[model samples]
Target chain A: MKFNVKIEVMLKPGHSDPEGETTARALRELNYPIESVSVSKVYMVVLEAGSKAEAEKMADGMCRRLLANPTKDDYRFEIRETR
Target chain B: MKFNVKIEVMLKPGHSDPEGETTARALRELNYPIESVSVSKVYMVVLEAGSKAEAEKMADGMCRRLLANPTKDDYRFEIRETR
Candidate 1:
C-alpha cells in the first residue's frame, strides 16, 4: 500500500524565531493588526509500505533522522492511504 | 477575537524543488524506501480581529502580499479562534 505523509516541524515555545519575528515586523509595518508570526516547515512524502503501522514507523523515523531538528523543533505527522 | 491562522505555501507542480530533492537523496542514502519528497512552508500567525471573516480576509491579503510567491507557489490557510 502507498501512503501520503504530511509532516509539520515547528520550533518549541521559548525559542527565538528570527524569520517569524522579522516577518511579523514587516507585516505590522504594512498596517495589519498582527501580534506575531512563527514559521515552520511541512514535508509531503509519498512512499509505500506493507501496512499502515509500517508507514507510521517509517514516517516517525524520517522525522527523527532528517526532517526535523530534535533539539529545537517539535514535529508531528499524519499518514493517509493514497492511490 | 483572537485567531490562530496556519498558512501553507508549496511550489506548484513541475517546479524544481531543490531542497526537497536534496533531502530525499540524503534519506535514500540512509536506506529508507522513499519515492519522492516535496517541501512546503507553514506560517502560524496569531492575531486579533473583529470576526472570522475579517481574519480570513487579512490572512488572504497577507499571503497575496508577502507570505507566498503567487506565480510559482500555491497557498492555503485555516483559521481557528483562540483564547
Candidate 2:
C-alpha cells in the first residue's frame, strides 16, 4: 500500500525565527513595509508500507526522532492512503 | 494593502535529500516497508506593503535572495489580496 503524508513543522509562538527575520529584513531593503512574518518548514512524503497502522507508527517515530524537535517546536501531520 | 503569499520550495529533481534519506532509514528500522520519500520546505507569509506592484516586487526579491537558493531549488508562490 502507498501513503501520502504532509508534515508541517513550526516554531512555538514567541520563539524567534532568524531565517524569517533575515528574509523580512531583505524585504525592507527591497522597499516593503513588512512588519512581521512567520516562516516554517513543510515536508511532504510519499511511501509504501505494509499497512496503514504500520506506516503510521513508523512515520510517527520519524517525526519524534528527527523531523521535529519536541522541545521548542510542534508538528502536525496528515496521512492519506493512495489508491 | 495586505497580501497573503504561499511559497513552496522544492529541490530540483534528482537532488539527494539527506534528511529524507535519514528518515527513510529510520523508518526501515521501525519495520516499515518504505521504499522512497521526498521532503521539502514550505513557507507562508502574510505582510502589509504599499501597493500590489511594490509588494510583488519585494516578495519576489525576498524569495530570490533567501527563500530559495539559486542553484538547486525552484519555488512557486501564490499571492492573494485580502479585503
**Candidate 2 C-alpha lDDT tens digits along A1-83:** 88987878889888888888886787677766677666777776777877778768767877787778988788888888997
Candidate 2, residue A37: Cα displacement in angstroms equals: 3.0
Backbone clash pairs for candidate 1 read none
DockQ of 2: 0.53
| lDDT (10s digit) by residue, model 1, range B1-67 | 9999999999999999999999889889878888899999999999989999999999999999998
Interface root mean square deviation per prediction: 0.8, 2.5
Off by over 4 Å in 2: A50-58, B50-58, B80-83
lDDT of 2 at A55: 64
| Model 2 chain B weakest 10-residue run by lDDT | B30-39
Best lDDT among the predictions, by candidate number: 1
Local lDDT at A46 for model 2: 77
Most DockQ-accurate candidate: 1
Give a tens-digit lDDT track for model 1, residues A35-56. Answer: 8999999989988899999999
Candidate 1 residues lying further than 4 Å off, grouped into runs, are none
Q: What lDDT tens digits, residue by residue, belong to model 2 across residues B1-83? A: 88887778888888888877886787667665667666777666778877777667767877797778878888888788878
